[model samples]
Target: MIRPDHPASFLEEGPFRTEEDQYFWKALVELTAMEETNQGNLAAFVGVSQGYVSKILAGKQVPKARLRRRFAEFFELAYEDMVALGRQHLESMGYPAEGLPGRRCQVREPAYGGAEAAGRPAAGQGEYSALRSMVRDLRAREAREGTYTEIPLREATASMGGGSTETGDRTLSYLSFRTEWIRSKGNPEYMTAIRAFGDSMEPTIADGSVVLIDEGRRQFVKNKVYYLRYNGQMYIKRLVDAGGRLGIASDSDNNLLLVSDADDFEIIGRCIWTARELD
Candidate 1:
Protein backbone atom coordinates (compact mmCIF):
# COMPACT_ATOMS: atom_id res chain seq x y z
CA MET A 1 0.00 0.00 0.00
CA ILE A 2 1.28 3.46 -0.92
CA ARG A 3 0.89 5.65 2.17
CA PRO A 4 0.46 9.37 1.58
CA ASP A 5 3.68 11.06 2.71
CA HIS A 6 1.80 14.20 3.75
CA PRO A 7 0.33 14.67 7.21
CA ALA A 8 -3.32 13.66 7.66
CA SER A 9 -4.02 17.25 8.83
CA PHE A 10 -3.29 18.51 5.31
CA LEU A 11 -6.35 16.66 3.92
CA GLU A 12 -8.74 18.26 6.45
CA GLU A 13 -10.30 21.00 4.34
CA GLY A 14 -13.35 22.29 2.44
CA PRO A 15 -15.18 19.95 -0.02
CA PHE A 16 -13.49 16.82 1.38
CA ARG A 17 -16.29 16.16 3.93
CA THR A 18 -17.97 13.49 1.83
CA GLU A 19 -16.67 9.88 2.06
CA GLU A 20 -16.30 9.83 -1.72
CA ASP A 21 -13.59 12.50 -1.44
CA GLN A 22 -11.47 10.45 0.97
CA TYR A 23 -11.72 7.35 -1.23
CA PHE A 24 -10.82 9.43 -4.27
CA TRP A 25 -7.65 10.82 -2.71
CA LYS A 26 -6.52 7.49 -1.20
CA ALA A 27 -7.28 5.56 -4.40
CA LEU A 28 -5.55 8.14 -6.53
CA VAL A 29 -2.35 8.04 -4.48
CA GLU A 30 -2.40 4.23 -4.25
CA LEU A 31 -3.02 3.77 -7.95
CA THR A 32 -0.28 6.25 -8.78
CA ALA A 33 2.27 4.44 -6.61
CA MET A 34 1.16 0.89 -7.61
CA GLU A 35 1.98 1.64 -11.25
CA GLU A 36 5.32 3.18 -10.10
CA THR A 37 4.48 6.01 -12.48
CA ASN A 38 4.11 9.79 -12.15
CA GLN A 39 1.00 11.97 -12.56
CA GLY A 40 1.14 11.60 -16.35
CA ASN A 41 0.86 7.80 -16.25
CA LEU A 42 -1.85 7.93 -13.56
CA ALA A 43 -3.82 10.45 -15.59
CA ALA A 44 -3.69 8.24 -18.70
CA PHE A 45 -4.87 5.18 -16.73
CA VAL A 46 -7.86 7.08 -15.30
CA GLY A 47 -8.48 9.04 -18.54
CA VAL A 48 -7.56 12.34 -16.90
CA SER A 49 -4.77 14.89 -17.35
CA GLN A 50 -1.44 14.85 -15.48
CA GLY A 51 -2.23 18.29 -14.05
CA TYR A 52 -5.51 16.96 -12.72
CA VAL A 53 -3.72 14.19 -10.80
CA SER A 54 -1.23 16.66 -9.37
CA LYS A 55 -3.95 19.10 -8.38
CA ILE A 56 -5.93 16.35 -6.65
CA LEU A 57 -2.88 14.97 -4.81
CA ALA A 58 -1.91 18.43 -3.62
CA GLY A 59 -5.49 19.03 -2.36
CA LYS A 60 -5.61 22.02 -4.70
CA GLN A 61 -8.66 20.63 -6.60
CA VAL A 62 -11.75 18.68 -5.63
CA PRO A 63 -13.02 15.90 -7.93
CA LYS A 64 -16.61 15.87 -9.06
CA ALA A 65 -19.11 13.45 -7.46
CA ARG A 66 -19.14 11.14 -10.50
CA LEU A 67 -15.36 10.78 -10.62
CA ARG A 68 -15.13 10.12 -6.88
CA ARG A 69 -17.08 6.88 -7.19
CA ARG A 70 -15.05 5.87 -10.23
CA PHE A 71 -11.81 6.50 -8.35
CA ALA A 72 -12.94 4.33 -5.38
CA GLU A 73 -13.89 1.52 -7.75
CA PHE A 74 -10.59 1.76 -9.59
CA PHE A 75 -8.70 1.50 -6.28
CA GLU A 76 -10.94 -1.33 -4.91
CA LEU A 77 -11.61 0.48 -1.62
CA ALA A 78 -14.49 -0.69 0.57
CA TYR A 79 -17.49 1.63 0.69
CA GLU A 80 -17.28 2.13 4.47
CA ASP A 81 -13.54 2.83 4.36
CA MET A 82 -14.05 5.43 1.71
CA VAL A 83 -16.71 7.21 3.74
CA ALA A 84 -14.89 6.89 7.03
CA LEU A 85 -11.68 8.33 5.62
CA GLY A 86 -13.57 11.24 4.16
CA ARG A 87 -15.27 12.00 7.48
CA GLN A 88 -11.95 11.95 9.32
CA HIS A 89 -10.32 14.27 6.82
CA LEU A 90 -13.27 16.66 6.77
CA GLU A 91 -13.61 16.75 10.58
CA SER A 92 -9.91 17.49 10.95
CA MET A 93 -10.36 20.54 8.73
CA GLY A 94 -13.41 21.83 10.75
CA TYR A 95 -15.80 20.96 7.89
CA PRO A 96 -19.13 19.30 8.52
CA ALA A 97 -19.30 15.71 7.19
CA GLU A 98 -22.62 15.30 5.42
CA GLY A 99 -24.47 12.32 3.97
CA LEU A 100 -21.69 9.79 4.38
CA PRO A 101 -22.47 6.37 2.95
CA GLY A 102 -23.32 3.86 5.68
CA ARG A 103 -21.48 0.56 6.00
CA ARG A 104 -23.19 -2.31 4.16
CA CYS A 105 -22.49 -6.02 3.94
CA GLN A 106 -23.91 -8.32 1.30
CA VAL A 107 -24.55 -12.03 1.81
CA ARG A 108 -24.88 -14.37 -1.18
CA GLU A 109 -26.26 -17.91 -1.11
CA PRO A 110 -23.86 -20.67 -2.13
CA ALA A 111 -24.60 -22.65 -5.31
CA TYR A 112 -24.66 -26.43 -5.71
CA GLY A 113 -23.88 -28.71 -8.69
CA GLY A 114 -25.88 -31.95 -8.17
CA ALA A 115 -27.70 -34.13 -5.60
CA GLU A 116 -25.18 -36.96 -5.33
CA ALA A 117 -22.42 -34.42 -4.77
CA ALA A 118 -24.33 -32.05 -2.53
CA GLY A 119 -21.91 -29.77 -0.70
CA ARG A 120 -18.96 -31.84 -1.93
CA PRO A 121 -15.54 -30.36 -2.58
CA ALA A 122 -15.46 -28.54 -5.90
CA ALA A 123 -12.80 -25.92 -6.45
CA GLY A 124 -12.83 -23.40 -9.29
CA GLN A 125 -16.38 -24.59 -10.18
CA GLY A 126 -17.93 -21.29 -8.98
CA GLU A 127 -21.38 -20.61 -10.48
CA TYR A 128 -21.39 -23.79 -12.60
CA SER A 129 -21.32 -26.06 -9.57
CA ALA A 130 -23.83 -23.90 -7.72
CA LEU A 131 -26.32 -24.11 -10.61
CA ARG A 132 -25.99 -27.92 -10.86
CA SER A 133 -26.51 -28.30 -7.13
CA MET A 134 -29.59 -26.08 -7.15
CA VAL A 135 -31.20 -28.09 -9.97
CA ARG A 136 -30.59 -31.37 -8.17
CA ASP A 137 -31.98 -30.07 -4.90
CA LEU A 138 -35.07 -28.62 -6.56
CA ARG A 139 -35.84 -31.93 -8.29
CA ALA A 140 -35.38 -33.94 -5.11
CA ARG A 141 -37.57 -31.55 -3.10
CA GLU A 142 -40.36 -31.70 -5.68
CA ALA A 143 -40.29 -35.51 -5.87
CA ARG A 144 -40.51 -35.85 -2.08
CA GLU A 145 -43.49 -33.46 -2.05
CA GLY A 146 -45.29 -35.54 -4.76
CA THR A 147 -47.16 -32.73 -6.52
CA TYR A 148 -46.86 -30.82 -9.73
CA THR A 149 -46.55 -27.15 -8.71
CA GLU A 150 -48.74 -25.19 -11.06
CA ILE A 151 -46.96 -22.98 -13.60
CA PRO A 152 -48.40 -20.41 -16.02
CA LEU A 153 -49.75 -23.02 -18.40
CA ARG A 154 -50.87 -20.51 -21.02
CA GLU A 155 -47.46 -18.89 -21.49
CA ALA A 156 -45.58 -22.17 -21.09
CA THR A 157 -47.86 -24.03 -23.51
CA ALA A 158 -47.76 -21.23 -26.06
CA SER A 159 -43.97 -21.25 -26.02
CA MET A 160 -43.86 -25.06 -26.47
CA GLY A 161 -46.43 -24.89 -29.34
CA GLY A 162 -49.39 -26.21 -27.28
CA GLY A 163 -48.49 -29.89 -27.11
CA SER A 164 -50.69 -31.89 -24.72
CA THR A 165 -49.28 -34.72 -22.65
CA GLU A 166 -51.11 -37.31 -20.47
CA THR A 167 -49.83 -37.25 -16.91
CA GLY A 168 -48.87 -40.83 -15.97
CA ASP A 169 -51.87 -43.31 -15.86
CA ARG A 170 -54.49 -40.58 -15.57
CA THR A 171 -57.28 -40.88 -18.12
CA LEU A 172 -57.97 -37.13 -18.24
CA SER A 173 -55.37 -34.97 -20.08
CA TYR A 174 -54.18 -32.09 -17.94
CA LEU A 175 -54.10 -28.90 -19.99
CA SER A 176 -51.01 -26.74 -19.64
CA PHE A 177 -51.11 -23.03 -20.41
CA ARG A 178 -48.09 -20.89 -21.24
CA THR A 179 -47.41 -18.33 -18.50
CA GLU A 180 -44.41 -16.80 -16.70
CA TRP A 181 -44.55 -19.32 -13.83
CA ILE A 182 -42.24 -22.26 -13.13
CA ARG A 183 -42.78 -25.33 -10.96
CA SER A 184 -40.91 -25.50 -7.63
CA LYS A 185 -40.29 -29.21 -8.28
CA GLY A 186 -38.78 -31.59 -10.89
CA ASN A 187 -35.65 -31.31 -13.09
CA PRO A 188 -36.97 -28.15 -14.71
CA GLU A 189 -34.98 -26.82 -17.65
CA TYR A 190 -33.42 -23.37 -17.36
CA MET A 191 -35.38 -20.56 -18.98
CA THR A 192 -34.41 -16.94 -19.52
CA ALA A 193 -36.38 -13.74 -20.11
CA ILE A 194 -34.84 -11.44 -22.71
CA ARG A 195 -36.03 -8.00 -23.74
CA ALA A 196 -36.19 -7.39 -27.48
CA PHE A 197 -34.34 -4.21 -28.43
CA GLY A 198 -34.34 -3.95 -32.23
CA ASP A 199 -37.01 -3.62 -34.94
CA SER A 200 -35.75 -6.68 -36.82
CA MET A 201 -38.80 -8.68 -35.78
CA GLU A 202 -41.25 -5.81 -35.87
CA PRO A 203 -45.09 -6.17 -36.10
CA THR A 204 -45.10 -9.76 -34.85
CA ILE A 205 -42.54 -9.15 -32.05
CA ALA A 206 -41.96 -5.47 -31.50
CA ASP A 207 -39.06 -3.82 -29.70
CA GLY A 208 -39.11 -3.36 -25.88
CA SER A 209 -41.10 -6.61 -25.47
CA VAL A 210 -40.06 -9.48 -23.23
CA VAL A 211 -39.70 -13.06 -24.49
CA LEU A 212 -39.36 -16.24 -22.44
CA ILE A 213 -36.93 -18.75 -23.96
CA ASP A 214 -35.94 -22.27 -22.93
CA GLU A 215 -32.18 -22.51 -23.37
CA GLY A 216 -32.41 -26.33 -23.40
CA ARG A 217 -34.36 -26.40 -26.66
CA ARG A 218 -31.80 -26.30 -29.46
CA GLN A 219 -33.90 -28.12 -32.08
CA PHE A 220 -35.21 -26.09 -35.02
CA VAL A 221 -38.66 -26.50 -36.61
CA LYS A 222 -39.77 -25.07 -39.92
CA ASN A 223 -41.65 -21.75 -39.89
CA LYS A 224 -41.43 -21.35 -36.12
CA VAL A 225 -40.05 -18.33 -34.25
CA TYR A 226 -36.83 -19.32 -32.52
CA TYR A 227 -33.97 -17.57 -30.79
CA LEU A 228 -30.93 -18.03 -33.02
CA ARG A 229 -27.39 -17.40 -31.78
CA TYR A 230 -25.02 -16.13 -34.46
CA ASN A 231 -21.72 -14.29 -34.19
CA GLY A 232 -21.97 -13.12 -30.57
CA GLN A 233 -25.56 -11.84 -30.29
CA MET A 234 -28.91 -13.64 -30.30
CA TYR A 235 -31.65 -12.98 -32.86
CA ILE A 236 -35.27 -14.14 -33.00
CA LYS A 237 -36.32 -15.33 -36.45
CA ARG A 238 -38.30 -17.99 -38.22
CA LEU A 239 -36.42 -21.03 -39.49
CA VAL A 240 -37.50 -22.41 -42.87
CA ASP A 241 -36.11 -25.13 -45.12
CA ALA A 242 -35.25 -23.41 -48.41
CA GLY A 243 -34.71 -26.12 -51.00
CA GLY A 244 -32.13 -28.48 -49.41
CA ARG A 245 -30.53 -25.88 -47.08
CA LEU A 246 -31.89 -24.09 -44.02
CA GLY A 247 -32.98 -20.46 -44.48
CA ILE A 248 -34.04 -17.86 -41.93
CA ALA A 249 -36.68 -15.16 -42.43
CA SER A 250 -38.11 -12.25 -40.51
CA ASP A 251 -41.82 -12.30 -39.69
CA SER A 252 -42.40 -8.58 -40.35
CA ASP A 253 -41.05 -8.92 -43.88
CA ASN A 254 -41.00 -11.78 -46.45
CA ASN A 255 -37.33 -11.30 -47.32
CA LEU A 256 -35.06 -14.37 -46.96
CA LEU A 257 -31.83 -14.00 -44.96
CA LEU A 258 -28.45 -14.63 -46.59
CA VAL A 259 -26.75 -17.75 -45.28
CA SER A 260 -23.06 -18.60 -45.54
CA ASP A 261 -22.62 -21.53 -43.06
CA ALA A 262 -25.20 -23.33 -40.93
CA ASP A 263 -22.56 -24.28 -38.37
CA ASP A 264 -22.00 -20.63 -37.48
CA PHE A 265 -25.56 -20.25 -36.20
CA GLU A 266 -27.05 -22.10 -33.24
CA ILE A 267 -30.70 -22.59 -32.31
CA ILE A 268 -30.93 -21.31 -28.73
CA GLY A 269 -34.61 -21.89 -28.09
CA ARG A 270 -38.04 -21.88 -29.75
CA CYS A 271 -39.97 -18.72 -28.93
CA ILE A 272 -42.57 -19.93 -26.43
CA TRP A 273 -44.44 -16.69 -25.70
CA THR A 274 -43.89 -12.96 -25.63
CA ALA A 275 -45.10 -10.34 -23.12
CA ARG A 276 -45.53 -6.78 -24.29
CA GLU A 277 -46.77 -3.71 -22.49
CA LEU A 278 -49.19 -1.40 -24.23
CA ASP A 279 -48.39 2.26 -24.62
Candidate 2:
Protein backbone atom coordinates (compact mmCIF):
# COMPACT_ATOMS: atom_id res chain seq x y z
CA MET A 1 0.00 0.00 0.00
CA ILE A 2 1.23 3.53 -0.75
CA ARG A 3 1.74 5.82 2.20
CA PRO A 4 2.44 9.52 2.48
CA ASP A 5 6.03 8.96 3.63
CA HIS A 6 7.07 7.15 0.46
CA PRO A 7 5.30 9.52 -2.00
CA ALA A 8 5.35 7.09 -4.89
CA SER A 9 4.83 3.93 -2.85
CA PHE A 10 1.81 2.83 -4.91
CA LEU A 11 4.20 2.11 -7.74
CA GLU A 12 5.37 -1.00 -5.95
CA GLU A 13 1.91 -2.44 -5.26
CA GLY A 14 -0.33 -4.84 -7.22
CA PRO A 15 -0.08 -4.69 -11.03
CA PHE A 16 2.22 -1.73 -10.62
CA ARG A 17 4.91 -4.24 -9.58
CA THR A 18 5.94 -4.21 -13.21
CA GLU A 19 8.11 -1.32 -14.33
CA GLU A 20 5.79 -0.39 -17.21
CA ASP A 21 4.16 2.47 -15.30
CA GLN A 22 6.02 2.95 -12.04
CA TYR A 23 7.26 6.39 -12.88
CA PHE A 24 3.90 7.68 -14.04
CA TRP A 25 2.28 6.23 -10.95
CA LYS A 26 4.90 7.94 -8.85
CA ALA A 27 4.14 11.29 -10.45
CA LEU A 28 0.38 10.72 -10.12
CA VAL A 29 0.64 9.86 -6.45
CA GLU A 30 2.59 13.02 -5.79
CA LEU A 31 0.10 15.14 -7.69
CA THR A 32 -2.95 13.62 -5.98
CA ALA A 33 -1.45 14.01 -2.51
CA MET A 34 -0.85 17.73 -3.01
CA GLU A 35 -4.49 18.55 -2.08
CA GLU A 36 -4.50 16.48 1.15
CA THR A 37 -7.57 14.49 0.11
CA ASN A 38 -8.37 10.84 -0.56
CA GLN A 39 -8.59 9.07 -3.93
CA GLY A 40 -12.27 10.03 -4.20
CA ASN A 41 -11.50 13.73 -3.94
CA LEU A 42 -8.67 13.37 -6.42
CA ALA A 43 -11.09 11.74 -8.84
CA ALA A 44 -13.57 14.54 -8.35
CA PHE A 45 -10.92 17.22 -8.70
CA VAL A 46 -9.64 15.66 -11.91
CA GLY A 47 -13.16 15.28 -13.34
CA VAL A 48 -13.21 11.47 -13.51
CA SER A 49 -14.97 8.61 -11.78
CA GLN A 50 -13.39 6.94 -8.78
CA GLY A 51 -13.10 3.63 -10.62
CA TYR A 52 -11.10 5.37 -13.35
CA VAL A 53 -8.77 6.76 -10.70
CA SER A 54 -8.32 3.27 -9.28
CA LYS A 55 -7.34 1.94 -12.70
CA ILE A 56 -4.68 4.60 -13.15
CA LEU A 57 -3.31 3.99 -9.66
CA ALA A 58 -3.19 0.25 -10.29
CA GLY A 59 -1.24 0.61 -13.54
CA LYS A 60 -4.15 -0.93 -15.45
CA GLN A 61 -4.58 2.24 -17.48
CA VAL A 62 -2.53 5.08 -18.87
CA PRO A 63 -4.36 8.37 -19.23
CA LYS A 64 -4.01 10.63 -22.25
CA ALA A 65 -0.93 12.85 -22.10
CA ARG A 66 -3.16 15.92 -22.33
CA LEU A 67 -4.92 14.80 -19.17
CA ARG A 68 -1.63 13.93 -17.53
CA ARG A 69 -0.27 17.38 -18.36
CA ARG A 70 -3.37 19.13 -17.08
CA PHE A 71 -3.16 17.39 -13.72
CA ALA A 72 0.59 17.99 -13.70
CA GLU A 73 0.07 21.72 -14.08
CA PHE A 74 -2.71 21.57 -11.52
CA PHE A 75 -0.11 20.23 -9.09
CA GLU A 76 2.19 23.12 -10.12
CA LEU A 77 4.67 21.09 -12.19
CA ALA A 78 6.32 23.17 -14.88
CA TYR A 79 5.72 21.87 -18.41
CA GLU A 80 9.44 21.15 -18.66
CA ASP A 81 9.36 19.25 -15.39
CA MET A 82 6.26 17.40 -16.54
CA VAL A 83 7.92 16.19 -19.77
CA ALA A 84 11.10 15.31 -17.93
CA LEU A 85 9.08 13.27 -15.47
CA GLY A 86 7.37 11.38 -18.32
CA ARG A 87 10.67 10.57 -20.05
CA GLN A 88 12.19 9.56 -16.77
CA HIS A 89 9.23 7.26 -16.07
CA LEU A 90 9.57 5.47 -19.41
CA GLU A 91 13.34 5.11 -19.03
CA SER A 92 13.08 3.73 -15.52
CA MET A 93 10.56 1.17 -16.82
CA GLY A 94 12.85 0.13 -19.68
CA TYR A 95 10.00 0.40 -22.15
CA PRO A 96 10.04 1.77 -25.70
CA ALA A 97 7.98 4.95 -26.17
CA GLU A 98 6.58 3.78 -29.49
CA GLY A 99 2.95 4.05 -28.35
CA LEU A 100 2.30 6.68 -25.69
CA PRO A 101 -0.18 9.41 -24.89
CA GLY A 102 1.17 12.58 -26.45
CA ARG A 103 4.38 14.49 -27.08
CA ARG A 104 5.59 16.85 -24.37
CA CYS A 105 5.91 20.57 -24.81
CA GLN A 106 7.86 23.09 -22.70
CA VAL A 107 5.08 24.52 -20.52
CA ARG A 108 5.59 27.05 -17.73
CA GLU A 109 3.59 29.48 -15.71
CA PRO A 110 3.54 33.09 -16.79
CA ALA A 111 6.28 35.02 -15.00
CA TYR A 112 5.23 38.36 -16.45
CA GLY A 113 2.13 39.07 -18.50
CA GLY A 114 2.23 39.79 -22.26
CA ALA A 115 4.84 41.53 -24.49
CA GLU A 116 6.78 42.77 -21.48
CA ALA A 117 8.73 39.48 -21.49
CA ALA A 118 10.13 40.34 -24.95
CA GLY A 119 11.88 43.40 -23.49
CA ARG A 120 11.35 47.06 -24.42
CA PRO A 121 11.20 47.68 -28.16
CA ALA A 122 11.84 50.80 -30.29
CA ALA A 123 8.62 52.61 -31.24
CA GLY A 124 7.53 51.45 -34.71
CA GLN A 125 4.18 51.35 -36.65
CA GLY A 126 4.10 47.53 -36.75
CA GLU A 127 5.01 47.20 -33.07
CA TYR A 128 2.43 49.87 -32.16
CA SER A 129 -0.37 47.96 -33.96
CA ALA A 130 0.63 44.66 -32.38
CA LEU A 131 0.64 46.24 -28.93
CA ARG A 132 -2.78 47.76 -29.53
CA SER A 133 -4.28 44.40 -30.60
CA MET A 134 -2.75 42.57 -27.69
CA VAL A 135 -4.09 45.09 -25.20
CA ARG A 136 -7.56 44.88 -26.72
CA ASP A 137 -7.67 41.08 -26.60
CA LEU A 138 -6.31 41.02 -23.04
CA ARG A 139 -9.02 43.38 -21.83
CA ALA A 140 -11.78 41.34 -23.52
CA ARG A 141 -10.62 38.03 -22.05
CA GLU A 142 -9.98 39.57 -18.63
CA ALA A 143 -13.60 40.64 -18.50
CA ARG A 144 -14.58 37.03 -19.09
CA GLU A 145 -11.62 35.40 -17.39
CA GLY A 146 -13.72 33.13 -15.20
CA THR A 147 -15.24 31.37 -18.27
CA TYR A 148 -18.47 30.53 -16.48
CA THR A 149 -21.78 28.99 -17.63
CA GLU A 150 -25.06 29.83 -15.97
CA ILE A 151 -26.69 26.71 -14.47
CA PRO A 152 -30.29 27.19 -13.46
CA LEU A 153 -31.18 26.61 -9.84
CA ARG A 154 -34.47 24.75 -9.61
CA GLU A 155 -37.06 25.38 -6.89
CA ALA A 156 -37.54 21.62 -6.61
CA THR A 157 -35.79 19.97 -3.74
CA ALA A 158 -34.25 16.47 -3.82
CA SER A 159 -35.60 14.82 -0.69
CA MET A 160 -33.20 12.60 1.16
CA GLY A 161 -36.24 11.04 2.89
CA GLY A 162 -39.59 11.99 4.48
CA GLY A 163 -39.72 15.27 2.56
CA SER A 164 -41.40 15.16 -0.84
CA THR A 165 -39.95 16.63 -4.00
CA GLU A 166 -41.54 19.88 -5.11
CA THR A 167 -42.82 19.23 -8.61
CA GLY A 168 -42.74 22.91 -9.39
CA ASP A 169 -41.32 24.30 -12.59
CA ARG A 170 -39.47 27.08 -10.86
CA THR A 171 -35.91 27.97 -11.79
CA LEU A 172 -35.07 30.67 -9.27
CA SER A 173 -31.82 31.85 -10.84
CA TYR A 174 -28.38 30.58 -11.84
CA LEU A 175 -25.05 29.47 -10.40
CA SER A 176 -22.01 30.52 -12.37
CA PHE A 177 -18.36 29.41 -12.29
CA ARG A 178 -15.57 28.99 -14.79
CA THR A 179 -16.67 26.33 -17.28
CA GLU A 180 -13.10 25.00 -17.51
CA TRP A 181 -12.51 25.31 -13.79
CA ILE A 182 -15.41 23.12 -12.65
CA ARG A 183 -14.96 20.92 -15.73
CA SER A 184 -11.50 20.30 -14.38
CA LYS A 185 -13.24 19.36 -11.14
CA GLY A 186 -16.16 17.49 -12.75
CA ASN A 187 -18.21 17.49 -15.97
CA PRO A 188 -18.62 21.15 -16.90
CA GLU A 189 -21.21 20.85 -19.67
CA TYR A 190 -23.54 18.62 -17.64
CA MET A 191 -23.20 20.46 -14.33
CA THR A 192 -26.16 21.94 -12.44
CA ALA A 193 -26.83 23.06 -8.86
CA ILE A 194 -29.59 21.57 -6.70
CA ARG A 195 -31.18 22.22 -3.33
CA ALA A 196 -30.98 19.32 -0.87
CA PHE A 197 -33.70 18.44 1.64
CA GLY A 198 -33.95 16.00 4.58
CA ASP A 199 -31.02 14.22 6.24
CA SER A 200 -30.75 10.77 4.71
CA MET A 201 -27.55 11.69 2.91
CA GLU A 202 -26.30 13.34 6.09
CA PRO A 203 -22.57 14.14 6.49
CA THR A 204 -21.95 13.39 2.81
CA ILE A 205 -24.78 15.57 1.53
CA ALA A 206 -26.43 17.47 4.33
CA ASP A 207 -29.96 18.79 4.67
CA GLY A 208 -30.74 22.08 2.96
CA SER A 209 -27.53 22.22 0.99
CA VAL A 210 -26.71 23.21 -2.57
CA VAL A 211 -25.03 20.47 -4.55
CA LEU A 212 -23.51 20.27 -8.01
CA ILE A 213 -24.69 17.47 -10.27
CA ASP A 214 -23.21 16.20 -13.54
CA GLU A 215 -26.15 15.26 -15.71
CA GLY A 216 -23.88 13.74 -18.30
CA ARG A 217 -22.80 11.13 -15.78
CA ARG A 218 -25.74 8.84 -15.11
CA GLN A 219 -24.14 5.43 -14.92
CA PHE A 220 -24.70 3.54 -11.67
CA VAL A 221 -21.15 3.68 -10.40
CA LYS A 222 -19.92 2.34 -7.10
CA ASN A 223 -18.61 4.75 -4.43
CA LYS A 224 -20.05 7.79 -6.18
CA VAL A 225 -23.16 9.69 -5.09
CA TYR A 226 -26.00 9.97 -7.61
CA TYR A 227 -29.23 11.92 -7.88
CA LEU A 228 -32.15 9.56 -8.39
CA ARG A 229 -35.87 9.89 -8.87
CA TYR A 230 -38.27 7.12 -7.85
CA ASN A 231 -41.86 6.55 -6.77
CA GLY A 232 -42.93 10.14 -7.21
CA GLN A 233 -40.03 11.31 -5.05
CA MET A 234 -36.47 12.41 -5.63
CA TYR A 235 -33.30 11.63 -3.72
CA ILE A 236 -29.53 11.83 -3.66
CA LYS A 237 -28.09 8.38 -2.99
CA ARG A 238 -25.08 6.22 -3.73
CA LEU A 239 -25.58 3.28 -6.05
CA VAL A 240 -23.92 -0.11 -5.96
CA ASP A 241 -24.62 -2.43 -8.87
CA ALA A 242 -24.87 -6.01 -7.72
CA GLY A 243 -25.04 -8.42 -10.64
CA GLY A 244 -28.60 -7.77 -11.87
CA ARG A 245 -29.67 -5.67 -8.91
CA LEU A 246 -29.01 -2.20 -7.49
CA GLY A 247 -27.95 -1.54 -3.93
CA ILE A 248 -28.66 1.92 -2.58
CA ALA A 249 -26.68 3.14 0.41
CA SER A 250 -26.73 6.40 2.32
CA ASP A 251 -24.43 8.10 4.78
CA SER A 252 -27.33 8.33 7.25
CA ASP A 253 -28.64 5.17 8.85
CA ASN A 254 -32.24 5.78 7.80
CA ASN A 255 -32.01 5.19 4.05
CA LEU A 256 -31.01 1.94 2.40
CA LEU A 257 -32.74 0.22 -0.49
CA LEU A 258 -31.79 -2.87 -2.44
CA VAL A 259 -33.73 -3.56 -5.57
CA SER A 260 -33.54 -6.28 -8.16
CA ASP A 261 -33.88 -3.57 -10.72
CA ALA A 262 -34.28 0.22 -10.52
CA ASP A 263 -36.02 0.28 -13.89
CA ASP A 264 -38.89 2.30 -12.49
CA PHE A 265 -36.48 4.95 -11.29
CA GLU A 266 -34.78 7.70 -13.26
CA ILE A 267 -31.24 8.72 -12.57
CA ILE A 268 -30.70 12.47 -12.63
CA GLY A 269 -26.95 12.76 -12.46
CA ARG A 270 -23.84 12.20 -10.40
CA CYS A 271 -23.34 14.47 -7.42
CA ILE A 272 -19.94 16.05 -7.85
CA TRP A 273 -19.83 18.89 -5.26
CA THR A 274 -21.96 20.01 -2.34
CA ALA A 275 -22.12 23.05 -0.04
CA ARG A 276 -24.17 23.46 3.14
CA GLU A 277 -24.44 26.73 5.06
CA LEU A 278 -23.75 26.87 8.78
CA ASP A 279 -27.16 28.25 9.63
Alpha-carbon lDDT, every model: 0.50, 0.61
Model 2 C-alpha lDDT per residue in residues 1-279, reported as the tens digit of each score: 112444334345444443335445545643333223366656777788878877775456667756665655555454345445545544554433433322111111111222334243323325344333433454455446446667777776787776466756477888877677676776565767878888888888888899888889888778688888876678888887656577777788845677645345878898888888796
Q: What tens digits encode model 1's per-residue C-alpha lDDT throughout 138-159?
A: 4464444344332222222112
Per-candidate alpha-carbon RMSD to the true structure:
20.3, 19.3
| Alpha carbon RMSD to native, model 1 | 20.3
lDDT of 2 at 239: 83
Assess every candidate by TM-score. Answer: 0.34, 0.46
Task: Give the Cα error of residue 158 in candidate 2, in Å.
Answer: 0.1
lDDT of 1 at 115: 23
The true-versus-predicted C-alpha distance at residue 181 of model 1, in Å, is 7.6
Candidate 2: list runs displaced more than 4 Å: 1-142, 167-169, 242-244, 261-263
Report clash pairs, candidate 2.
none
